[model samples]
Target: MAYQQQQHYQTQQPMPTMGMQVGGGNRNAAGKPLDSNGKREWSHGLCGCFEECGTCCYACWCPCIVHGKNKQRINHLAAKGSPDPDGGACCSGSCWGHCLLTSFLGAGWILQCINRGETRGRYGIEGGGCGDCCTSLCCHSCDLVQVSREIELEEKSFGQRY
Candidate 1:
């Protein structure tokens, strides 16, 4: 019996590269593209708070209202879908509870500080001016006003852009 020798050749194929995009091109938490103008990407300078009289007044008198509104917006943006049924209640309760609790005891800046930290964490903002708590403690109203402005502007920009 004679066995015939057979040779098999293997063909090489190039592997496909992932080609993942970097920097994600400035996407929001919901994976949506932010406005190219970048108007809503970051907070305005804290010193500019007085330039917007309306925001300053609102933040001054009823920080809870501003904070609650900002919180709601942030939550909404993060959710990026049907609004949460308990969104209003949760925001109201948390804002009121924290604001009242912090204020009555002369520590009103605490909540703002925490919220500032949260904003920074969400938006990838760098901390500045002796840390969140100190910055908020020193410029509590400005912080609240600035945060409110940022979220409001961002939501509006989102609507306009998409």
Candidate 2:
């Protein structure tokens, strides 16, 4: 009876083969496969802003422009091949909003935090809301550049897929 029971239990369990997508296979919005934990690190670190001097300068001098461009890219990716609702404009409402908020309320970090969180979630980036808020509040310019680089990398990878 014990031998028969062991055979039955072993037959009921099937092992996953190599390259098999177990648990329906987790993927990010860009359709990239994720690890077992369903998370990945950022392509660039916050302090690596100098890696892209032009982008770093742009973000430092005119953050609104970089913010707008980043938003447009994210929207384009989210929309896949569809038309972007923001019309892919660099000076869209989001950019203006960031500018106005920073110019007046000095609370532009709020919008930055929101955008960062959204980007992290879409890319399955390993981060939490608290970290996002702190990064946006403390290293505003670096955060923008980091996100810009990440979106650019994602676009490159996504483009190759099709």
Candidate 3:
């Protein structure tokens, strides 16, 4: 009886196929599958800023909040997991100094902008309809909403790529 049960279990196991999607999973959610050039494109264009009304409005009115949230989400996705998810030094332990810099130097946006570049790198998304620094500096609200949308829409199936 033991030998028979062992054989039954062994035969019941599912076989792993090469490149076969196991369960209606999408490996190409980030736009088209990798081309011969080996790059994946963003599912949505940067100019599609108004695609998400809530994100656009939030980014417009509360730029800092939008940037902070985008930074956190990007960090989480890029690192698989990150302790400093907010990308804020205060939250990561250096409270007073970071607070001072934010208040006086006004450099908090730099971290968020860096994360935007990181997100572009991860998905091979192109930059420079206006360029990263200019987009982050001049049209920050639009850039924030666009980045948030890209991550939200495209990252749904990203983990399975591994």
**TM-score for all predictions?**
0.63, 0.72, 0.58
lDDT of 2: 0.75
* lDDT of all predictions: 0.62, 0.75, 0.57
lDDT of 1 by residue, 50-95 (tens): 9889869877787677667667756766666323234333357657
**Residue ranges of candidate 1 with Cα displaced over 4 Å:** 1-42, 81-91, 128-130, 160-162
What would you estimate as the lDDT of candidate 3?
0.57
2 versus 3: better lDDT goes to: 2
Give the clashing residue pairs of candidate 1, or none.
none
Count of backbone collisions in candidate 1: 0
Cα lDDT tens digits for candidate 3, 119-161: 6775556554347777776766677777776666434554432
lDDT of 3 at 99: 37
Candidate 1 displacement at residue 153 in angstroms: 3.0
lDDT of 1 at 136: 77
- Candidate 3, superposed: residue stretches over 4 Å from native: 1-30, 33-36, 81-109, 128-130, 158-162
Better of 1 and 2 by lDDT: 2
Model 1 accuracy (lDDT, Cα): 0.62
- How big is the positional error of residue 138 in model 3, measured in Å on the Cα after superposition? 1.8
Which stretches in model 2 have alpha-carbon errors above 4 Å?
1-36, 81-88, 158-162
